[model samples]
Target chain A: MSSGEAGWEERSVARIVPPIRPRKLAKVPFVELAEGRLQGVVSSGSSATRVYVSSIEAETHDFNCSTNNNRPCGGAQGSFHCKHLKALIDEAVKQYGLERVARYLKVEAAEGDDLHSLLNGKLVKAPAAVVFSRFLRHLTYLKVPAGSEPLPEMHWFPALKAVH
Target chain B: MQGVQLAELVQTPPGVDEAMEAVAGFDAALADGLSRLGPRHSEAVDALAGAVSASPLGAAAADACGELAVGSISDTELSALAGARAALLGAVHDALLARLDGALGRTRAEWEEHPADAQEPPANLLAGARSWLRELAIAGWRGVDEELVSAADQTLEALWAEPRLRRLAVLLDGLAAELRVSCPVATMERIPERRWADLWTRAVLLAHSGSWTGGAAAVSGRLLPLGVDVHEHGTAVQAQLHAVLEPRGDGPVRLVRAAVAAAKVDTIVGPEVWDLLSGHPTLLAAIAERRAVDIADMPLTADGDLLWDEERAKAGEPADPFATARVRLPDAEAPAVAPLDRHPVRIAEPVLVEGYKAKRDGTFDLGGAAIDVDADRLPPSGPLTPQLVNASTACIGLLRWDAGRWTLQPLAVRSVAKKQPVEAHNGDWALGPTDPKAAKALARSGSAVAVLTERAGKLLRK
Candidate 1:
């Protein structure tokens, strides 16, 4: 670290939570902070077409892990997190960094508290239908070919008034 | 094309052909989109309108030249002088540049997509263009000979007919069109310096003409590494490393480019480019990889580009660029707002902008004004990483007006000054031997490029 990095960390970051650890690569392919939740799809280790839709709710730390078809995971039981649910958290940390994920989840993290340490007791089961449907809809975008022709769906995204 | 609403450019990302399509019906679009753009920037359009739409000045120049003709002049002959004066007026230059940008980018993308078609410049065609230029140069003020003009036109027309060659052929044909005008020549210069230089820069870039050394000067600075580059001139493939520097003495901020050319017949953008660099000097490797260096006195261009002369320029010390008191970002000047021409330029204003915010869209959210970037044209490189919006507070770059908003092609970026600032780029790579493997990949190189440099060339010449 250069001499000013310590001070830069202080200035560039808001002190809402302890500075997050440097994030690593995604443990799973997809993760995002949308629908007021840290949620995305994770591929199944043993199955090819099979994907587990996982999410941790923003407000309640309510967690859900199930096959896209609603079959519940064997690992996500009681207070323990399955690998898919943990992968979702890991990827969220990678995407938004540790501090943002902690802040968004309303985790009270102190200095040197890794993500898992901060979110120790804040999880419970939640319905997975909304997230799974959203994931299915999200997969539809992958087929959207690159082009400039006004898209039918995009037409509803009101044209912003021209910048003067 | 009319200058877009700056906000519109920022808010609307192009859908591939958005800018091109909009520019196609530029005049009508301008009338509908923006009634009035900057009058100063309209010089090209106005001049072009005058040139094509029967200009009184062009008529006068034509009439003056028409009388001096030793024989009868054709309609084609008369229009040549007039059109050159009125300009395409800048449209030819703009269209040529845009096409070149698109073509090269497309070719590169295509190669990335389908590596099978990274075809070498069809040598004979390039040779034809080269011969046409040489013939034009030989003809000089006396005006190009008719036979040569006829032959070159045949070749140029064929070049134009080919879709792949269209972009590269634009400048060649443009120069041919300028050279072959049937109007009688006098001792006076025909084209303006701006047009001449503009054509020259694009032409050299297009042709990849090999090696031209600039006048040398004793220069020194706390060289902040900016970008790495590579280009293939006809005879040689050159690798260049660029840096922005603060002079050792009291002077304005300047840029330094260190370049080396290898006599190679292979394509510069080939698979084994690094292997070729492997045997070159340490500095060439450093050029291949943008590296920060601290130097006392080095032989460089008046603009501060390090010369190829090994005995003159000392190999600089490897150091971290961000370990500094401050980072300077010269306020880049935008040409009069012209929609047709992006008029991209490296920054010029002596200004330090700190505490600005970077956005996910590759723009620095400088309060009300935001500078946008196109991942296609200028991907955030060096210290301006993929996470620039999250990482750095300040960005250094080439500035241009695209669509409507002022855009920046980022060169370098760094954290804040209040702390141990971290730059996305530094000179740590130069500590190793000159084996070329140390050079960061995706680096750019050039030949006969010193004449076409952005920030440094402009500053020193002034």
Candidate 2:
């Protein structure tokens, strides 16, 4: 597309799009745990997108996103965002490549969760690229002690990188 | 009787016997003077003139002769004699009058000076007057006239002239009569009769010995006549009787022994032995033994049942009614999640993008936007996660978002590729290693190429 057309098309794309779903590949991996009486599942999609698993004992979490269809999505019924959703998204990105993880990093993914929604779709811009460049420099320079657990999943790092 | 006789003696007639007794002794002195008579007179005549001057008859004759002598004289001779006599008599009378006047004046002066001593009867004069009046009043002397009363009044007045004498006479008279008794000694006798009687009564009361008889009689009337004196006998008698009659201390112990003895008596003989046991000893033993019997032998009625019911009712009283039950909570476990990395995240000093501008010349611009990173600017010690990244970046990032309207994300880079001249250009753009070479080549040819670096692209997509 022409540059002007591209900008116009991006604005239109932003308005019309609902959230993209993670594409199915070969197999999805998952972990099981319990909180109170409810059991939870932490899983990775075929594209290494993270998803959460839960079943109702009394009430369900709003950000639960788990389904019998094996395709992770949103809409559940609890007051607060669920930890299962967070675990699913974080594990998906860490295990898979960033390009394959884009579908899960959509604006809607970070909407209920506090972190990754900050980036949204601003990655195509030059200024956003520069900011991402700076953030990469920061990540490369970051020193983590050996044998330590990885950092807890949060959305703001990439979002801040997009803004620079 | 003597008081009556004395009263009679005082009332006896006063006559010439008093006058004759008054002249009798002076007649003997007159006769002796006549024996020593003057020479010109006959002895008989001298004796007769002296006798006339001294005897009772002679005293009367002398009065007549003195009148004759005055009568026979001539007027001038009598006048001269009378004048001389009158002058002599006047001189003697004047001297005597002066003496009497001095004494009477002294007496009156003392009377006036101590008027109470003079006017009022001395305490002693009152005592004497009280005695005399008491005696006269006791006697039948109803009509003593004012003259006699005046004489008695004058006598009391003279006696009362000296206070000491008046007091002494009062004290003496008081002693003489039992009507008003004096104290043990005279000076202390001045207490009034009422006060004296009170003192005497008090002294008698304090003696105490006389009232003991009456007190004993009163006590004896109440207690001694009763038969309770049997308990007052010696302790040995009580002990001996107690040993023979009731040998043990407790009622049940004595009752059991008496029951055993009674059983033995009944066992030895039949109804005849029981009849022999009908006297006082048997009655008292039976009474004493009755106390040892258990209540099981007694008949029960509604009254007994009520008493027992009351005791049982008291024992089963209900416990406190307002007690509260305790509530127990079920155990709950915390959700299991992956633990956060304990390693702290360190952010270095940020590159100053504004002040170090890309210039055509070698010099850097100091006025452009600057970035400063301080490690101290990090939030206080707590969970360090990627969430803190934006919070820290926003502190230094001069950016704004239109809240609730547009979610615009601003980039931190500025385009400086155009400002670079061809002579100095080693590469067309300053994009880092993650950028594709084709884009770099395109940018070197003065074309706008979108540069994508692997790390930068990954962060953007996330």
Candidate 3:
């Protein structure tokens, strides 16, 4: 039990003993480059380690990733890049440790590429900019609030949309 | 020359004179036959014309003549008659005209003054008069008005009746009026009494058959006015009346009873009552077996009230003995040491015992030796042992051992047992196991022989 506690301490060591100067960026207002719409507010509380891109015009494609390219071009087959993904990554890095955020982003990027490829030609084709625009409008009408920042980015978003 | 003379005589026969004379003779015979047959033919023509003019046959003949004139009559006889009447009337007119110098007016006037009456009656006198004329006019008539005669005939037949039927009609009209006033409908028509009776009877029958609502009440109420006592007479009368009125089938006694039972009335009538009465013979049986009877009122005597008061006063008197006190004995307790020689202890009354124990202070343990005796039969000892002193008492004698021997003592006694030789035995033994050793010892002592015999008998039976 002592060793297990020590191991937990080691894994959470950075969180308990935060770095003297944690990487951070200034809080920025989220904006869709194409639509010039004020989408939401973004803060660099803990998710400054990774880059995140969000779009009010293209909700389905908006995403957070290690790289600036939201699309998983190399291997992102069935990826769901959305404002929620961006918000979650930002949340996870801010609330939890950056190491977990980085690890989470990498795994999510690989899984997203695989899913994108698998469902490329199916009825549930990845929503490109055009479909994303429609989805964004729908979400805007529904008024779905922004998700928590620094979310666990390693969690895979299922390709299945709303069943109904 | 002689031949000439004979020829001259024959020559004279071939002259115009001889031919003229022969023609004149033949004309005269023809005229005579014509005169005779012409009058008879004229008479026949006159007779036929009169018949045709005066009777339906005359009209027919006239019509036949007109039809013949227009080439419509094809019958030979009718055609001949028409031709003959035409000729006769024409001849008569012509003759009259000749006599009146061809003045048609004068001739018509003379005929009108003395109109021709044939020797025989018209051929269709009965058929040709007003009846036939009317028939002719009606034959050509059209429209529903043509049925007026037939309609009138039907109306008359429908309205016709015997005196009894008329009376019935009157009664029915009156009854219908009454019914209308009593139980009116929207539309009122004076229905005959027989019809009303029939309707009422039918309604009642339907009610009996369970066809109408409140039919039983309606029937009974209606029947009551007719002097029918449904409840008293039973359903039989109602049923018979129903059969008399409507003769359809048996009255619905069952339905009526069910209805009456539903109504839960003291008295019911009509079919419902009949139904109940007929179905439940138990009702009649209960009535027959009714046993409750009312007591008659007591008659008042001159001194009845006074006597009753005196009796009551005597009963209210107080009893002679005011109060009573009962003294109970204490129960017997076992002694620590059994008496060497059993001395019979007599208990005059029941008692309650406390407990048994020896006393202190060098004195004998009298707790177990205290004995209570009757005050009247107090022993010489001062107090009785505790074993004898079964329970507490206000007045009693107590005995105790001064040295170590059993003694007798007396206690206060409210009463004592009337019998002598009061038996004393160990209450424990009396209530506990029947030991044969004790029994033999008792038998040897020759005490309680009856108890021993009973115990022996009980052991034998076991």
The CAPRI quality class of candidate 3 comes to: incorrect
lDDT at A13, model 1: 10
> Residue by residue across B1-462, what tens digits does model 2's lDDT show?
012222232221332223222222222222222222234222333233344344334444344335333333222222222222222222332333233223222111110111111223244443444433322222212222223233333333333234333222222222222121111212321222211121112212212111110000000000000000000000000000000011123221110001101101001111112222222242222122211111112111110100011111111112110010000000111111111110011001011122233233322223432222211111111112223322221111111111001111211222223564111110111122112543343334221011112222433333
Q: Where does candidate 3 stray beyond 4 Å? A: A1-25, A29-40, A43-98, A102-164, B1-462
Encode model 1's per-residue lDDT on B1-462: one tens digit a residue.
012222333343323233223222222212211123244323332333334445444554444234323333332332343233324324432443344233222111110111223446566665666555444433432443445555675555445444445334444544444333322233323222223323433343344421222234566656655554333321123344555566678755654455543332111222223334433355543443444455566655433346444443334655333332134322211112122112222111111234666677666566666655423222111122355435676654433333223444444456655678655432222233232432333222232122112212322222
- What's the CA error at residue B460 for candidate 1, in Å? 42
Pairs with steric clashes in candidate 2 = A50-A88, A51-A88, A115-A155, A116-A155, B124-B170, B354-B369, B434-B453
Q: Provide fnat values for all models in the order shown.
A: 0.00, 0.02, 0.00
Per-residue lDDT of candidate 1, residues A45-113 (tens digit): 887557787888765776778877788888887667889988878766654566667866778766456
How high is the CA lDDT of each candidate model? 0.41, 0.22, 0.22
Q: lDDT tens digits, residues B1-462, model 3?
A: 012221221222222233222222222222222122244433433345444465444655555434433434233323334233333323332332232222111111111111222233222321222222122122211111223223222212221122212211122222222232222221322212112222222222211211111100111100000000111110011110000011113332110011001111111111122232232232222111211111122111111100011111111112110011111111111111111101111111111222222233212222323332212121111122233333322222222111112222322222223543221111112121134554443334232222222223432222
Q: Model 2, clash count?
A: 7
Candidate 1's error at B423, in angstroms? Answer: 4.7
lDDT score for residue A134 of model 3: 27
- Regarding lDDT, does 1 or 3 come out ahead? 1
Against the hidden true structure, what lDDT does model 2 obtain? 0.22
Ten consecutive residues with minimal summed lDDT in candidate 1 chain B? Answer: B106-115
